[model samples]
Target: MANNQRIQLKGRVFITFNIKAVTGLHIGGTESGIEIGGVDKTVIRDPLTNRPYIPGSSLKGKMRSLLEKYKGLRQNQRIGQGYIHSCDNPEEYPNCEVCQVFGVPGERDFATPTRLVVRDVMMTDKSAQDLEVSGRTDLPYTEVKTEVSIDRVTSAANPRQMERVPAGTEFGPAELVYSLYDGDGCDVQKDIEHLRTLVEGLQLLEDDYLGGLGSRGSGKVKLENITVALRVGETYAEEKKLLDKFENLGCLVEKLKELQDQIRQHVGK
Candidate 1:
């Protein structure tokens, strides 16, 4: 008979941060396809506000891809498969860290719930106002970056226009929530380990790029003012109290380490 068990909610950790463009950022949007006159690539934007924004999907996808590559988990079978690769074969590999946090596809019989939730990043009010004052005059809040590709044989330069959110643009504060579970056989250590991995993934992302055209001096970004809050147990009161415990990125990491040490002590008992 198959084992039947359900995971129970324990608590949650909420992390908030800011993303500032260090170079032109270009997360692509739908092509206008006005063949006569249109940029080759366009940045994604908010329809109502008409301001460029970063999608949570784009951030999460990029982080997962970077972490997978760092962990050497990017085998041929998993490369474009979209997080569905199996980790059920314990003999081959036990406790796949990536899947446990990011989640495996529904088809995986042993799949657990995804622990991470990334929120869409919107432009700060000040950034929007700055754009308005600067007066782009032509493209509004975005910059039209032009590039030329040389033909190898004829050495002819072909120019194309690319739309991007320019450097110094700020969009955030981005939010990420990590869920902790409670159950009879819950492994708290695993949850802590997952948190560490997730934070490390963000650090790796900071060292890398956010959107597209990274190779051509676009998409460099910096994450700042990271703050984290944690709530324990299953009550609104506890959550309310936890709101006062927000800490900066450094303090938060230290607290997590302290928590891990305490858990280790209890487990050792």
Candidate 2:
């Protein structure tokens, strides 16, 4: 019966925030076509604007990876060249927060709608303008950082240049859209809980790092100026702000019950 059921969209919660680069952030992109003296590693950028931006896939993947590790979930599913944790058992799909929020393989018999959508974050106009005219940036709105590695056997030093968005730069307003659903043995409760998991993932990301070169000190980020709104069921046409501008995820964490209460008040109708 569960396998034959259909899922229905109940609502969506919108989370918007700013990503402040506390340290030089590096999310590598192709190093092709650079001059001999150019950076060997480069941050990913929007093709149209040539401004380095955070890809949704990068953030979402990082969150999922962190959550999986936190939950001690098994990494059994192979995705491209990497392996990610996925609960293959349909029976367990509804119960696993990672799978419920991130989703499972399409071929799975119990495949249900994934509840989360993370959007690519772009630079704020102010940041873009500041970096553009600052004259300190090596490239457009970015800086080149050179790093060195010591060869163990040869006892030699090899230096490589990496492109990064300079510290104190901000990219936003970052957005995450979370969908609530019904049917298929799932209810709004599960979706609501998944929302909690979603927020937790973001919290995990802040403590961890974003992009590459994290271990050696890069990709440190903070989520700030967060606002959460919702559009639910009968009132789907109208967007209501559950939580007004909060400073960070920690603030939201303290108010989860209130957030849930606000959601319940709206949806219980």
- The models' CA-based lDDT, in order, is 0.73, 0.86
lDDT of 1 at 132: 88
Tens-digit lDDT track of model 2 for 1-269: 23567877777888999999999999888877888878898888999998889999999999999999999999998989999999888667767999888877777777787778899999888999999889999888888888899999998999988889999999999999988888765688767766788888989999999999999899999999999988887778775656556898899988887887777676662
Put down candidate 1 lDDT per residue, 1-269, tens digits, no spaces. Answer: 01474666666777788889999889999886647677888888899999989999999888877887888773434446454344554333326666667765565555556778899999999988998899873487889998999999999999999998878989989999887764533455577667888887787787899999998999888877776666655453544223323334455555767655543443331
The TM-score values for the models, in the order shown, are 0.85, 0.95
Index of the highest-lDDT prediction: 2
lDDT of 2 at 231: 87
Given candidate 1, what's the lDDT at residue 48?
98
Candidate 1 backbone overlaps, count = 0
How many angstroms is residue 157 displaced in model 1 relative to the true structure, after the best TM-score fit? Answer: 1.4
Q: If candidate 1 were superposed on the true structure by all CA atoms, what would the RMSD be?
A: 3.7
lDDT of 1 at 93: 30
Clashing residue pairs, candidate 1?
A: none
